[model samples]
Target: MNRIRVLVVDDSAVARMALSRILASSGRIEVVGAARDGAEAIKMARELRPDVITLDVEMPGMDGLKALETLAAGPWKVIMISSYTTRGAEITVKALEAGAADYLAKPSNISEIDRVSSALIEKIEAVAASTAPLRRKKRPIPPLPKACSALLIGASTGGPRAIITLFGRIKSPLPWPTAIAMHMLPGFTAPFAKHLAEKTGLPVIEVTERVIAEPGFIYVAPGGKDMLISSSGRNVHLRPDEPKATYNPSVDRLLETGAEVWGQGVIALILTGMGQDGLAGARAVRGRGGTVLVQDEESSVVWGMPRAVVSEGLAHGIMSPEEMADFLEKIRSMA
Candidate 1:
């Protein structure tokens, strides 16, 4: 099998070398070239046509953001290599907007290279696997229907911040129930739900085994099990079941069942997360005439989940967290 070709671009010689060594250690990836700055990176990208590019946010002459725009014009995955600092976080967010796939921070101490190497390698491999092929030529979404009642949301890493941002933006008091299936530690779901409630003014609570779904309330799934929507006559219920997929509180599982219960009245939202866990489920929602909303790549902490839906043309709207709440309220009003 051919390995995934990689190119490293950084101003720091040590950083470039360290990143090169890490990629070289991975059998699945081959570091084809290394450049000291973005200008040289552009030259190497044109020549090598690498499968992926690891770029540094800060550099002399040309920076990663500029290099990303140039590289994004071509077919190549760009992962940002950043240091651990406030500026690093700010620039990394910009890199993502410029079309960088994801980011990994360099450790403050190089001696802990062994500790950081494996995690970095894993992130690179994951990005290499998901970031390509999903490059959308254009994002074409379906039209939102006049009426929607139930809403379902899914997310993973970097979800906490995104969720807070999202919940804060939900200005309309919901007229129908909302279900959230986020990938998080098992013990943290209750607190997370309460936190969301406090932050968003939405009444969020942990789903109990037999609790009936009520409008204006948010139900979060427990970490170890999958949450599904069940129908008792015309009323919907929230309950946890055995795990059926890699992620607990699997987004697909919730969406599949919710679509059945709510039908076209369901509105599914895919937020920032890792992997394509919700793509199939979002497709199901679209097929049933339900609307699917994806968090646009620019606003996401991680674009993997929303990117999956956007690439498939199943999404009805690519919205920012700030805009989603008001959008959802419109749906509520129409319903």
Candidate 2:
């Protein structure tokens, strides 16, 4: 079998050497080349034609962000390498928005480097597998969907990775609290929430009744119940009840309640899943003057729920899972 080819780009010689060694040692991956800055990286990426690029966030000329803009115009998948500093985090976020597939935090110590390397290899493989050939070079930007305050996101199969990708694209400390209805097996929600929190730097925890809703924190609905929001003035009331619908932690139920309670303040995002679980619920959000965003058909594994909304014109925007969080932030800012 062919190995996954990787190109390491970093201004710091130590960073480039450390990252290259890690990739070279991984049995399934091969280090194609290394570059000192974005310009060299972009030139070598087109020449080496690596499956993925590990890009550093800061450099002397043509910073990682600009290099991303250039590489994004081509075919290489980019995973940003950023430090733990606030500036590094901010630039990493920008790289994501500018079209990099993912980001990894730089290690503070040798042990941390090992940990980051392991994590980076896993993400690179996942992103490479999800790539679609013959991507459109220039993406036409659509106007931002109508503004909304409350956001409801639904995902099932392949949901965990998709949700993490979504959160990474959005800004932290949002204007309104968001909730997620993920149809995962019981006992997995806590772990999944923790995983999501680590990836996005957002607070994610299993929601219990009366837990206060705060901007920037995610209230992930526990798997065994139907979850909803009950709004009284500005306070959010978490409503967890027995399954009144086909899907446990029914996404439809969540969207229906969010629309009813928040009205025009709701924005529903339907992600990849096996069935039309969130389709009817999207209509509820739309009927209430809320905006609906569906994962584009090509990007979805099953595409049932998102496709349903798109076919019915219920969705105001069609985006990849990675774009949802940033799109939500844009909608909120507009509101």
Candidate 3:
């Protein structure tokens, strides 16, 4: 296999050097070039034609967001390098919605870069392997029971963009409560929820405590904790508990608990993400006679999570974000 080509872009020379070193350390990756700022990055991207670009969120001139607008229209994929700050989280979320394939939070201590090396390398590989988003295809809406009670979504690497796209296409309020378990850091979930509310014109709240789940509202699981449905199926609880798995805000915990509560009344949608975090939960949902829909490979930034469901014959349907929205709209219409 050919080494994945990468372009590292950061205004700070130290950052650029550290990033280049990290990428170079990954034998599977090749650091083709480095850019000082967004402007230079754009020019270099055109000339270097790398497979992926690690873009810094903030730069002296023409920041990552602006450069992303240009690069997103091109052939290469982008992975945002963000500071671990509230402001950085906000901008990174925006970038994800705009078109970034994924993002990595920059650590304050340069020595700590080693700690994140594996994660960074993994993200780069995933982004480079992902296919470009394709045009939505019309499909027969998957059948659902008349008494669907909740909508649960799980995602990771490429989830933010997929989630935002799905909600943006919905023209009316959904008839069921929506719970999202997107893999994110502690400080990032709040901004992500705020952005979702602003863009989707829906009441989006990050669940930091127990709350009553209600239709027409979106509940986002807070980072570093798991959000589970209470046995009543009417309450959402935030805690770090049971059926432990690799990722906080575990999708498995959410869907497993949801299956326990709602049974066949649950509709689980697995979107673009890396790894098989949602596969086991999807199985539980399917076993309970609930619906499981996955984002089709052609429309996913990374098809890992969804592919796991499809491979296991756990998905009731495979559709793009647009199609998922249309299906939800149909359910709303029936309701």
Best by lDDT: 3
C-alpha local distance difference test of each model: 0.75, 0.75, 0.91
The residue pairs that clash in candidate 2, if any, are none
How much lDDT does candidate 3 score?
A: 0.91
Give lDDT tens digits, candidate 2, residues 285-304: 88988878888756654466
Q: Which portions of model 3 show Cα errors greater than 4 Å?
A: 132-139, 241-244
lDDT of 3 by residue, 95-184 (tens): 999989999998987667778889999999998988766776766767866777999999998899999999999885687899999999
Candidate 3 shows a clash count of: 0
**Per-prediction TM-score to the true structure, in the order listed:** 0.60, 0.57, 0.96
Minimum summed lDDT over a 10-residue window in model 1 is located at 131-140
lDDT of 2: 0.75
Error of 2 at 167 (Å): 0.8
